[model samples]
Target chain A: MLGIDDPWIWGVYLLCIFSTLLCLVYGLVNWNKEGEQEALEEKEEEAWEESEEEMQQKELGM
Target chain B: MNLLLLNIIILIYLLATLYLGYRGWKSTKDSEGYLVAGRKTHPYIMAMSYGATFISTSAIVGFGGNAGLFGMGLLWLTFLNIFVGIFIAFILYGKRTRKIGHNLNAMTFPELLGKRFDSRFIQYFSGIVIFLGMPLYASVVLIGAARFMETTLAIDFDVALLVYSVIIAAYVIWGGLRGVMYTDAMQGTIMFVGMVFLLFMTYSHLSGIVPAHQALTDMANLVPAKLAALGHAGWTAMPVLGSTWWWTLVSTIVLGVGIGVLAMPQLVVRFMTVKSNRELNRGVLIGGIFILMMTGVAFTVGALSNVYFMQKLGNISINVAAGNADSIIPIYINAATPEWFVYLFMLTLLAAAMSTSSSQFHTQGSAIGRDIYETLTHKKGGKSILVTRMGIIAAMIIAVTLGYILPENIIARGTAIFFGLCAAAFLPMYTSALYWKRATKAGAIAGLITGTAVTVFWYLFIHKAEAVPLGICKMLFGRDVLIASMPWPVVDPILVALPMAILATVIVSLMTKGPRDKHLAECFRGVK
Candidate 1:
């Protein structure tokens, strides 16, 4: 049977698999970061509060 | 007997898709909702949708068929899909794309670029390229799905093509991005489950992974003479280095699609669909798993199919039995699986086709309607939506026409060509726009033009693959390529075009003055 004799070739294949697994692990480890729902809601609220302040200041000037 | 059950299942799928379309229609109150799902999509939905759009029948049927012929070496593409298409795309590109897209209120990829550069030409030009290039890619998806149906259902090829096109077009035109993503999530689930079963069944059929690969390797003498001439060493091993097969596999297929994923307008627009970077981040693992199952399984099963065919049919190769490489997967599934599983796999294939095509139609429609016509005319509100719908219809027609005309064994080549074109034409300028503070409007335009021009010139003139069929070089110069002295006869366009584009961008930016301070401040706001 014609089989792969080179150890380095197998190493490359293993490396590819290992890298993919590493990526998967990286993704799983960082599943819920500070960048998801709570952070987005906080940013939106800040924007809303700033807009409301600006409107109130405009009314006071008038 | 089974046809009636298959029909019922398809009818159910159609009804579900229609219902989702109605929900999308209701959710779409304004242009933003229709275009980018209002940028509040959940991580699960966004992740699944991105995976579905990114890995379609082109990966399963087209590239799977390729793996069957070319062997396990195609697995490198699987690695690239996960590493580049999913992880890097989400972490590096998706984060910045989402932030800047939100900051500029950009609806499409072209709009994001245009708004970032503060130039209407960059926006309209990229839109026009998407409008032109995406149809060929869409047509390949359409052809892949139709080929599967024709083999599985025993329907006329023309009828299958028409039915596939009509169903996907209806949802895309009526429901927009929301409808597209909703269907995509469901479709992605079906594809994952179907592929998992396929991989398991393939391994079991071959008596296990080691023996299966050993059998394939033992049959190294079975390599077609034509393929061997092209430097194919064996199915399991990488082709001889720098051989035509090696170049085709590495440069054209692997690097082309791997790098091309970053610049796809349909996929890039997906990053903007999520709410926060966390939602986008959450999508990374889900997308990773989904792509792994879809592509990893496809390449494995595709290669193992040779073992199955060899054991059963004596001497008939996959290409001989299926008549064409594109039809090999369906032919093998029909022979290998039970009746019930075949029916379910059919839906999985349909999901694969519809999800990708719907996104293509939507991206092209937005390119034409929102990016080109509306931006140029300064139109907004309901009028833009009307234009987009019309553009979707136009895209569907063009894709269907091309689907009918394309040749067999074209699914993989067509996919590679489009991906390669996108990489050459858009990747450099796109990456620079996101990361480079010194990138000027002049530089972006010059890069865009040079990249597209060089790729087209090479494909039409220098590359024997297209030149032989196009006959342009043969007619003008009595040879396939003008420069007959070149060592490599068929170098992929990306190898040459990408570097030229990158060089032009860097050189032009250095020569030009900095972009307006006001524009830079607004564009890079909150982007540290």
Candidate 2:
């Protein structure tokens, strides 16, 4: 196809380009899918961190 | 190129890198910030860091050099790298890893596995393996960057090695993952621009894409007798199926690295460096294009360098390099590109090397300090970071020493070896940790040991590429390989060890008790 005689070689060459387009399209389609959830996750993560710190302090007898 | 101008440009780049490192150091206020970029990295920075750390000088100088010798067959690795490394990795693995790691508060790859399975043994064992096994890989990367410096700047190799190591270590030890990823993003941009220019110049120099491929294909008859005997048919064709050349190309070069990318400790940790799946979704776009530019340009330029050399000097790339495939890309850049581009590409190679080296040192440090030492001593928080900094120094010394002692043309093979080992040893357990709820602590440990043992045994006793030079088989069994038979010695360890590890993991998990329901729930929390 691209002037290379081997189907195996040219097939992979085309596939590399195709795969990148797949990623670009996929990213664009879902760029903002979970926008609302991030804020909630951050709050939960902070709570989890505080509890984790308390548990570690208890273990160390601090 | 003007040495004075080049030196000033390099100084600016170095200063900029150090400035970014300082910014990272400034932001890092706790163990979490140092370990995982505070787990809220930007999508662009995360994607660029991942791609830059993943590509490295190994891809450009080493495998690009292999493309010079072997042909466009190496493009299959690029296909797998994009499809598997970015797309599947980000969508399928990244989301789950981020959630699970957050739930368990796991900072490193070993800690993730350790926390998931509730086994300190798994964490420390994996940590020990990484600490012991990664220097060979790191050293080869050091050698790749050093070789380019030697070739382009006319610097001594030893001086290049020492200077490169010190620069990478200074930032990695102080700034941690935050520093590594920040610099990686900037370095990745430089690499992207340099590679785009390289690909454009290559095709334009050869009069465009089709003409370049046609020229390479036309020169098939020039395949050296030695390479042809090993089943090298042409620069544009696949090696004769099942021939020695085919096995090395497919098994060692292509699949070894292509599939192996999934389990790399350094690359896999990037998945846990983000807040939510949205960032990963966005990252996939940037990562795909970045990887395409990096590997695609290098391999294409590597292969077409032959045509350029043939037309100019009536010799092929390997001959021009005097049989060292490692030198092909560097030689081509020096001979084919204009002077100004040479200076830009020098920064490109430097970025490639520094970005990856920084990540390796960080991962190795975490393995030793966070995973092994902290887990063993029951110490946590600030003390571990101090130990981690020490570990980084130890890793730097080992890698720099190896850069001095390791033989020429070892870059690509060394990289493949580490990737394959990680695939066999960690992939099964890592996969099971994410997807298989039934996977038990006993099962994970068994799989880890069996995969590691089998890979080490194969490298020492059967894989001729490593065994012959290692001479362990020759000393123990009075032969180069325990199996001197055709194709047996040629088969890569990943092909052998990975399947066995998977089987052991599945069967052992089924036979043993699974993790407690409470632990499993904790691991699976928020992990849709």
List, in the given order, the native-contact fraction of each candidate: 0.31, 0.80
| Candidate 1 clashing pairs, residues 3+ apart or interchain | A35-B278, A36-B278
Residue runs of model 1 more than 4 Å from their true location after superposition: A1-16, A36-62, B485-487
lDDT of each: 0.84, 0.94
Compare the candidates by DockQ and give the number of the best one: 2
- Name the best candidate (by TM-score): 2
Model 1, B124-230: lDDT tens digits are 99999899988889999999999989988899999999988889888888888999999898888888888888878887888776777788777788887888988
Question: Which window of 10 residues has the lowest lDDT sum in candidate 2 chain B?
Answer: B378-387
In model 1, what is the error at residue B197, expressed in angstroms? 0.2
lDDT of 2 by residue, B220-253 (tens): 9999999999999998999999999899999999
Best by lDDT: 2
TM-score of 1: 0.94
